[model samples]
Target: MTTAPLISLTWTDHVTGRQGHLVIDRLVRGVSSGGLRMREGCTLDEVTGLARGMTMKEALHYDPRKRYIPLGGAKGGIDCDPRDPQAYGVLVRYLRAMRPYIERFWTTGEDLGLTQDIVDRAVAEAGLVSSVQAVYPLLDDEAAARRRLADAFAVEVDGIGLDELAGGCGVAESVLTALDRAGVSREGTRVAVQGFGTMGGATARFLARAGLKVVAVADVKGTIANPEGLDVEALLAARDAYGTVHRTALRAHDAELPAGAWLSADAEVLVPAAVSYAVDTANQARVTARWIVEAANMPVLPDAEDLLSARGITVLPDVVVNSATNAWWWWTLFGDIGADADEAFAHIRRSMRALVEQVLTRAERDGTSPRVAAHAVVADRLPVIAERLGWYA
Candidate 1:
């Protein structure tokens, strides 16, 4: 196999007046973009890999939308602990120094550790234009600019709801896709979700409302399991601000399992909505669910995916899981309004359903798993973009 050439990479150490890292693994003409990830042990290679994923995602969107706008995938990372107050100034400085690059191709927003306030600070220090301002800078009123930015980022297709619904919708779609492939019905399917953050909580609520028996749910505090199913409303009320459902509060109806027992619970589907790499090689054997829907990015590593596949468990890849909502958000942000909000949502639903069906169909035809089949789909599409750009004859 031939190695891909590195496209753009730079490092800048603004806090110490030294160089820190800025990597652009691939570019798609006028459409290069990605999210900023802040974690304790993030690496340049990991960031670069994520950038490559973005490239595939954006390319997939362009073909379907037929916008012909140049778009590429890119990502940025910082290895600093977000809890440390002192690191805030350094991060701001580092971000400010990268203003020129961010202005040229990247438009960042809240990610894992980053918040809206942090994004605003970075934009101010860097003097980069906001997505709304980039299009309507002449509007003098400050309040108007803020409102426009909010609208630019708001959930237009579904109206202004909690951001958690995006995650829930992705999870719901993944579940439905996997069930369809497995010849299962979603009407009364049982599900157990681990991690009760934005994604997990929303997924639980949505699934419960969709008639899925939410037999088990867990968070940082502990796990709760009830074969007869638990009340999502009561669970939501018991959940704290951080989204952790108190085990003691739910003690009346269910037994408290081990912290990670949600994985082994009796259910047809398992949704990992927490942080990344939760289902690795160590706990792969403990996964008893027939299907695993990754609500979090890269929650299951490559090896774990292989292990589960070998055991006849269908694992839906995260690329398809999160990309639909992301595409919707990005499309709305860029002001590429569809016929209407309903029309926009329908577009997203169709794209997601098609991608899922494509992966499943290819997997069945090739006698391979969906994860492996996804790579081929991505590889085939990338070259078409390259050929269009004259990178391939």
Candidate 2:
């Protein structure tokens, strides 16, 4: 990472029992946060890279000139089949092991195979312990800690604002903002969303609500499309725990297509919300969308993004687009104790839209991708932020 990494530590993975890693790229208020991702190819290096993006995301949201919430960037990952029956216990143990760091340094929510339900279970235990320790020394009683823990979970696990949905909301915010900046109306604006999981499904539904046509949505099961737009709510009902919707879900209206069909869909916008590297060299040429808003981490490779930028495609970076929920996490924890899910969503939509617009303005004026422009913004603030946040001290 170009910026000095603050903390790098590994753990015995719950699912695989192999070595996995957690890294704190930066720290705000003596703490950091990000997602806990688990899949077949996950590695420490990948976690580090994701952590770096989290740092950039924090910088984007906590811009000193704007409404900011101080939060450092962090990420964690384990390599295993999270579908295994053993995953729950393993995840719980993982969190228990991370108890001290979580209390004092980092907190991870959900990502990839790690669902919000599982996240609730994993972090709930750690938060309880941390909350207990926080007040036990001074108050010398469990009542205060118990109350604190209850409040944190009330905001975190409540039905209205699941962490993954929050992420998807953020992605939708970026897409809407980018579209408005491009002078594209939401009415009849076709969107092809690849990877119809938590983030993708949420983005599709919100876009549909905003009068955009969700023409296509693809998951691991298959891709379903309708030029007139799919019924997002019905499709959502059919989605499985992992975000896949099979023939049973879209039974009558489904236009069964091959995998990766969303990439080539004739649409004004494309959102890659599932796997990383969806827009690599192999399929970069097939992405016909005028605006590519990366809803997933590292969805577009560097060279591929370069090619698209050269071809006049506006590529919004994942950090900026996916920053909403992270900011919400910090805000709910340290800024506003009474913030509800709707308020959090509205605030993030406003904040992220403004941030995306700023990046787009600078990028368009300077003939650079949104990512490069965003990096310049973060670079200018990093030195000062480092000093203030106790980096390299």
Candidate 3:
């Protein structure tokens, strides 16, 4: 009853003699690309599923008929911790071993623990296009290698960093998208962000500046609330690297509540930008936000999505919000786009806004949740490519 992976990949480092697992769950229209998540728990199946999401994301974002860019969904995973002393070398060797396969069928990018530096080193050592034509005859030309390296390198330089603000921007964008769908004005919209890390904090600050009152915010340490609004700058300064705001330092400004209390905060929009699977079936009942925007990947469980949808709470899926950063990276790296920081941010904003609007409109028309509507849209796009390739006949 289960389906098979569209593209399977395996790599062994020639230098370190270490083997890495890679998988592409689904190749939309025979083209595939996605982030390379390097972590101990990352599995072939998980990466493959991520790749399947990437396939849908690419299909929804990039139109081959209009843009001339044919992207499928591909993902690579190295089963090692970046903190390991030999991590860099192992990654280099992994890239060299997978160079042929990458050139032939996939493009790689940073994800999870894999940073831009690692990607740059890997691409550089692998020589963009691999010289070993036996593995990729179609990529025999040296120009292909150069192009690949150039593309990968560009993403490294232009891609979003691990800045705290990146997550906030994504959260803010998601909230904005949801409001737009409801035709609700944000002039005095109340918002609460659960997780004070880069994503949550940044979203709070941005939302505050945009006239939305950030009534509540929480971290691993505890939650803070002020029905009027919270001073984002002071709170950010009091927070630690893990996004935990020191409880002792909070006496100057507002009311401090227990950890994870933001879930019950009275707000129009609630953003869960912290850890994965934070909102599951158990806590789904406690959440009281009118709209939930996932600033983190899969913050809500599959079953919870249905629950929230039934309760009339709009849940904007993480697949699109978190992908804006990736889109910016891809455009900057492969499209030869983004000449400056401002331009790069603008590009991200434009892409995110357009995608949010498209998905929202589609969802409204179909009278379905945005996530389901997005899948439907992707389903529709797939057939066009299938027909083009004569697979639908």
Q: By lDDT, who's the top model here?
A: 2
Residue 368 error, candidate 3, Å: 1.8
What tens digits encode model 2's per-residue C-alpha lDDT throughout 120-199?
A: 76677655444223213223234643453345446643233455566777888888888787688889999999888888
- The residue ranges of model 1 lying beyond 4 angstroms of the native Cα positions read 1-22, 68-70, 116-118, 131-149, 152-163, 233-251, 254-256, 334-344, 389-393
Please provide, for model 3 over 205-260, each residue's C-alpha lDDT reduced to its tens digit, 9 standing for 90 to 100: 77887889888888766789888788877787777645678766654557888877
Per-candidate TM equals: 0.82, 0.88, 0.74
The candidate that wins on TM-score is 2
* Candidate 2 similarity to native, TM-score: 0.88
Q: After aligning candidate 3 to the native by TM-score, how far in Å is the CA of 103 from where it should be?
A: 4.1
Candidate 3, lDDT over the whole model: 0.67
Residue pairs clashing in model 2 are none
For model 2, the stretches where C-alpha displacement exceeds 4 angstroms are 13-16, 63-68, 124-164
lDDT of model 2 at position 242: 88
- Minimum summed lDDT over a 10-residue window in model 3 is located at 130-139
Stretches of model 3 off by over 4 angstroms after superposition: 1-3, 8-21, 28-31, 38-40, 64-70, 77-99, 118-171, 194-202, 216-228, 233-251, 254-259, 334-337, 386-393
Residue 169 displacement (Å), model 3: 4.3
